[model samples]
Target: MRSEPLRFFAWNLGLPLAIALAIFAVFDLTSLDEIISNWLYYPNHEFPFGHNRLFENLTHRWPRIIPDLTGEAAIIGSILSFIWPLMKPGKHDRLLRLLEALRIAPLLRFTARYRRDFLFIVVSFAVITGMIHFFKSHTSIYCPVETTLYGGTMEKKEWFENFSLFHEAGPGRCWPGGHASGGFTMVALYFVARRHQWRHARAILYASTLLGAIYGTTRVLQGWHFMSHTFWAGVIVWISALLTALAFYGWRRLASPAVQAPGSAPPAPEQALSGLG
Candidate 1:
């Protein structure tokens, strides 16, 4: 099989991006946002926060912890990628000890070992967060908590409807569910496992996707975002990571002649093209 960046991009990023767009379109046309929001919210104009608002309180607390945990994880991955070669740790050193305490030592070790692959993971987190924030800042789409149905100020605007290119009211920072981006950023983990362990990569990819969905669902229940908002966040993150991985492989192929040669086999493959094909 040949190393083809366009083919890789089409399968890994283009298709998933199209799916995400379709999802956003379907939810917009069907008014599923309002429907789902209504189902989760009680007649009292409040979320079903459980007895005496236990769930509401819990959901509220998530905003505080989720960003720090996920952002710090991404930052750590990037930092470790840059510093892995410089720092050497013993079998049971403090860095590993700390990672073990956080239950992410295996991920840290894996990223350190496959440093190049992990670069895409780091890039994915940055790109996903940046794009989500850009939309959240520019788009005037209000969150469910801000909509009239939930007893807030603004009317519930569809994904592509509200906001002007020149001047628009910034209702609040509430589009695309930035909190959920944290979970979806785990899509980078998929790239780390994709090369040598295709099966494991599939499992990791699905698990990361599911984790993002669950995180987004939590935001939906809390009225901070609609289901579609979180869905798009996951989609964007996945696509960003996929494209970054494609770029990585493209660069590897260019840098190493053996990987690109028609009849030559490299020590480590520049790509595993069967899946992309």
Candidate 2:
């Protein structure tokens, strides 16, 4: 039997547990006085770049790369968001069926065919969860600095003062916006799944990219993360996806069997080989 303890743990707990534990460990190891001094009084030690300036530039600039569209463009984006999934019906439908089967159908079929894919999905979810937790913890810890630098005072927003809202608001975390990470990861997955030019490929890719960009912008606009944090979050996610893909699929593809030569007969079935000889 395959030992999938890590996969099982990720499936059940997700990445947040790991992140939360790590944060707790950090807090325990470092003194509260030191943490406060490093973050607020002497921000230079915690984050070298001025947080406010970095955010202002990105909030003003990054949107221009894709052009901030008005009425019709916005409607088009909304329409595409709804329509893209319908364009490629196979995988999503299969996933739904698998879920249904888990609830109502037999277990054997699900395990036989969908186990690996399910493991991949679970791992993806775990990674996203971990990214979200990490972002939230880091952002909440640094919000005072960010608010002071950008809003010009410590008493700027109620949201900044309340850490619980980070979980309540959802996706308010400072670093790698979960939406951005998940959206881009979906794009990468789509790129791998459909090597050909499928109907939904272009639409899904464009929509996901847009969603990621919007998420990054929202994080900056909402004062949760600075421009540099958002930018680096994106960098971290891209690197993670690249590394995961290379480790899992890329290596496997390289080791897979080559295609048979044209017009050549396939190898005889093992059951028939002994009789034939």
Highest lDDT: which candidate?
1
Write out the backbone clash pairs for model 2: none
Candidate 2 residue 222 Cα shift, in angstroms, is: 3.2
lDDT of 1 by residue, 1-277 (tens): 3657566656776788798879867886887777888887867668754334666556545544654565566666656644333334554467656766987655544445455654555566677777777777677677887778787878777656664555544755677777677777776766655544444767877877776787778878778888888887877777666667667655333223122235443221112211121
Worst 10 residues of 1 by lDDT: 268-277
* Per-prediction TM-score: 0.69, 0.39
Cα displacement (angstroms), candidate 1, residue 159, comes to 3.1
- Model 2 whole-model lDDT (C-alpha atoms): 0.43
lDDT of each: 0.64, 0.43
Q: How well is each residue in 63-114 modelled by candidate 2, as lDDT tens digits?
A: 4343223223433433333222232235466754654567622232222222
